[model samples]
Target: MAGQACLFCEIVKGERSAHVVMDAPDAVAFLDARPLFKGHTLLVPRDHYETLTDLPGEFLGPFFEHAQRLAGAMESVLGAAGSFVAMNNRVSQSVPHLHVHVVPRNRKDGLRGFFWPRQKYESDEEAADYAARLSGGLT
Candidate 1:
């Protein structure tokens, strides 16, 4: 369910700001402000669904397609060996809206299972650069 108060809904409506990297008619991908890694991205549907179970069946394929695209871009644009793509239904989901996390991973990136230490962008310009590279990867 979407509400004007929902954080992701606000982002979708352009009431709030996010470092968006990819935009689609049904969903959008943006760099997480509090990233688990440099290119860590959060992809969410334009319409708000609180959890995976609430998401409509028809939206699943396209939503995940965006996730795949972002994951691929994570590796290609950021030099990650792979990506960790995941979503929380209702348990660990921070926002009320359904969103997937696509985190860039390396051989020894120090990310232990469930031990996610957050990182910050050196500067806004650097974050924008990462966004540009990711957008380039999409093309």
Candidate 2:
């Protein structure tokens, strides 16, 4: 279940806003606001599950299925050479909501290590496009 005020919960209910990339009765995908790569995306269950252990077995199957589809789509659409999927739990997670990050990787991107430095946004327009392009793939 989701609380009415949770940011992700609002996105699930079609309230607030997000550039959603994929949606189903049980899961939804959207671009990560703070991305490590150009097309980084997040896939989350519509219901609130704080950790992997909290999720029912049935939900896990479809969630990963959708993640795979979205990862493939990102590779093709974003011209990414590879991708990484990760989920953080209580110790590492900043948000309690359960979600997975699907990040696109490219050989030429010049990322020296797993922890690449983040860049600052110069304009709102760029952010808006990032959201829209990711959301477009949801369909």
Q: TM-scores of the models, in the given order?
A: 0.95, 0.82
Residues 17-105 of candidate 1: C-alpha lDDT, one tens digit per residue: 87889878999888899999998989999987888998899999988999988889988888899999999888887887899999999
**lDDT, candidate 1, at 134:** 93
List ranges where model 2 is wrong by over 4 Å.
1-4, 108-114, 119-139
Q: What's the CA error at residue 65 for candidate 2, in Å? A: 0.4
> Which pairs clash in model 1?
none
Which lDDT values do the candidates have, in the order given? 0.88, 0.76
- Could you tell me how far off, in angstroms, the CA of residue 96 lies in candidate 2 after the best superposition? 0.6
Scored by lDDT, model 1 comes in at 0.88
Give the Å error, residue 12, model 2. Answer: 1.2
Please give the distance, in angstroms, between residue 37's alpha carbon in candidate 2 and its true position after superposition: 1.0
* Collision pairs in model 2: 21-138, 22-138
